[model samples]
Target: MNPKLRRRAAGHGGTFSRQDAVESGYTVSQVRERLRDGRWILLRRGFYAERSDSTDRPPWERETEAHRLAVHAAARALAGSAVVISHQSAVVLHGLPSWGLDLDLVHVTRTDRGHGRILAGTSHHVGELPASAVTSAEGLPATTVARAIIETSCAARYEAAVVLCDSGLRSGLVTRTDLTEMLGQMSGWPGTGTPLAAVAFADERSESVGETRLRVLLDTHGLPAPDLQVPFGTGPNEVVARVDFFFREYQVVVEFDGMLKYRDDAVGAVVREKHREDRLRSAGVLVVRVTWDDLDQPERVVHRIRQAFARAERAGMRRVHP
Candidate 1:
């Protein structure tokens, strides 16, 4: 086997040993040569990793290679030990925007919990991981894409998971043709794939789902819907400063937030959104932010919006009276 390819194949999240390379027919000298030339970087004492999985990838090129690296390395180190990547790492494999929910921890399980902690970017979560959830990716083990989706997709922007499901379907990662065959193969597995399927088929454009859900709640309550995709100023095409589901006659803007919106990095994104709202407020737009809990309690959300509206109306009335 080609030493470089063997090293790449070792696993996405594992380290390579010298004995494994020699067994695959690469001399220690060859491995050392590659490392010296910077063709491969030493991940640890015995293992090496190539810098790029691909050359000159397009602008949209996903670091799928990086994901591949982590999974491959972990699996090789485990060597038929029956482990699955779970949590945020799995989310990255499933290609979803985790909405700030990522696995800083790498999960693996053995009847005896050792042989983890060799990989740098990995922290160990030792527990009862089933064999069925582990599947082959690039000849190494990884969490099943569906399983990862279930484990990690509970996010602030539900649409992030939805988009991942869509991409998986579009790329044939999951399919109708294999659904029946998987029933028996997946029988003992804990997840049955419904949530992943729901996210996969989520229609952002539909009247009842995704970001549109906010639009429906507003219309149901008789609020004027804001312009979707309205351009604020210009740099990119249709650049949006913030997202508002409703903007009534320049008096108010309604912002809808989901879970994860209140988490740490989201604070920066939220602040940028607030800045956008501030710019609008400077021009007399009153912004009211709504969240999932507010959506769950429409009375509260509606009452708040009504109050903003009333305040705007009172200001308008006062202007006339004055």
Candidate 2:
């Protein structure tokens, strides 16, 4: 690779345009050869990402990094300065939690008047993007966290919207008050109600996307609301465990087991979690576990939890007052 091209690629988060490669003393053939030899990755037409050997990161994290790179490349390719990254694109840049979002398109908002358009995997949203609604992420112009969450929530499904809103609030990227204010500003707009509902349902205590999705699922199934991040076995100065979901009335605890928890030290984490459950069980607490696969079958998960609740009720398990 040309030295100048290498430096340019390094500066642009390991992604660069064909024009950049050519201007840095590389020919079109060279670029094609590098791509064919696994030295670079073709992100989209005219955009390329330098290949790296690191494979230790999770798939989601790697995909998010790629999305960030594509957003930057798209911003550089745009003709004018009116575009600011928005929606799920901005969410990736801001390091906010997201799931089931389209990663192929570079999403941007145009401050000028016009309809949003898609071209070459780039999505442009043209509307009133005031200065206050804009911010910088990774040195690229993008929407503020609160604005991004609102924009995403309006366009996303109920589960995805709740996850984004919950993540934004939990990460302190946006405050509850700021989200409410943003909703007020976007009042009467089409699809505003979805975002409003998502914000209302969002809780900052949701520590992961899975937890947020579970909360939505439980609500959708008409199950009673479970206290989030609830503590069990509390005394004057003692606390045995902090559970994911606690149903005091039913003496049941629901845990959304994300892969990250056991990704490292899987055996040890499982052993520790088993012991914790044993202690809870000894105290007459019914513990139920939900995994990613369980999330896919919402009905089954609901049924299992309901069964657990019924069993706890039949056993007359005494609730531990925290």
Candidate 3:
């Protein structure tokens, strides 16, 4: 194996372009051969990704893989192309809720004639991006954190925008100047104004769609909000367990279990979660578990929550979704 190819293959997650492999000693023919033999998965015309057990992942995982491919292909979209994933696509990639489509197939591009976009599920826009607003995802350069914020944000995106700006910038993924500029540049788009509620949830720290959906439902049902990441003790505010939703006044916690909870190493996280649930249960707290399928029948979610609320009422414990 070419040292370059070998090194590129070493990473758990990354992408490759023809130029990289060419520099590594493999001709385009060899790259094509490697792909045909299942050693690689062609992400785009000149880009390749290794095929492994990771390729056997769920469809959504594959969708993300395809998205990475699209981002990789952006460099080849046209001569001097500067395409980057943006809009709902970046929001999903950023793992934030833009408009709550359980699954989304949208990305944005910076180019002329940005229109009824197709292929790669892309959307186009006319704009100039500061070099700083573009960052690479898994070796595929993408719109910068600020540009992504502008692309992904709508009225509903204020909270996500806040987090993307605050956390992303603070973490060194982006800069305040770019974020502010992007926000300003996109001021005229419909629903560009941020929402106060979204701003409030900026630091919510939700880790999954299930959690976000659960929080939305709770908020919609008018429940008093739960403290998202709580500290078990005061010394340094370490989180022994961070719950999906918890009503501290009633000693109740709820979590959602998607299929990910049943897989290999993930099952261990489930087991640990169950052990924590047991501890909370033994301590007289109520623990509730919900799953994606449960989300399909929201009444079920409402019923369980209502039952729990009734129990809390019986115990004279108060703190509802209001």
- In order of lDDT, best first, we have 2, 3, 1
Native-referenced Cα lDDT, model 2: 0.85
Per-residue accuracy of model 2 over 215-302 as CA lDDT, tens digit each? 9999999998999997776355666678889888898999998887887799999999888888777666889999987999999999
| CA deviation > 4 Å runs, candidate 2 | 1-6, 22-25, 53-59, 234-236, 318-322
Whose lDDT is higher: candidate 1's or candidate 3's? Answer: 3
Model 3, 16-43: lDDT tens digits are 6678788889888887798889887766
lDDT (C-alpha, whole model) for all candidates: 0.54, 0.85, 0.60
RMSD (Å) per prediction: 11.0, 2.5, 5.6
The total of clashing pairs for model 1 equals 16
In order of appearance, the predictions have TM-scores of 0.44, 0.91, 0.68
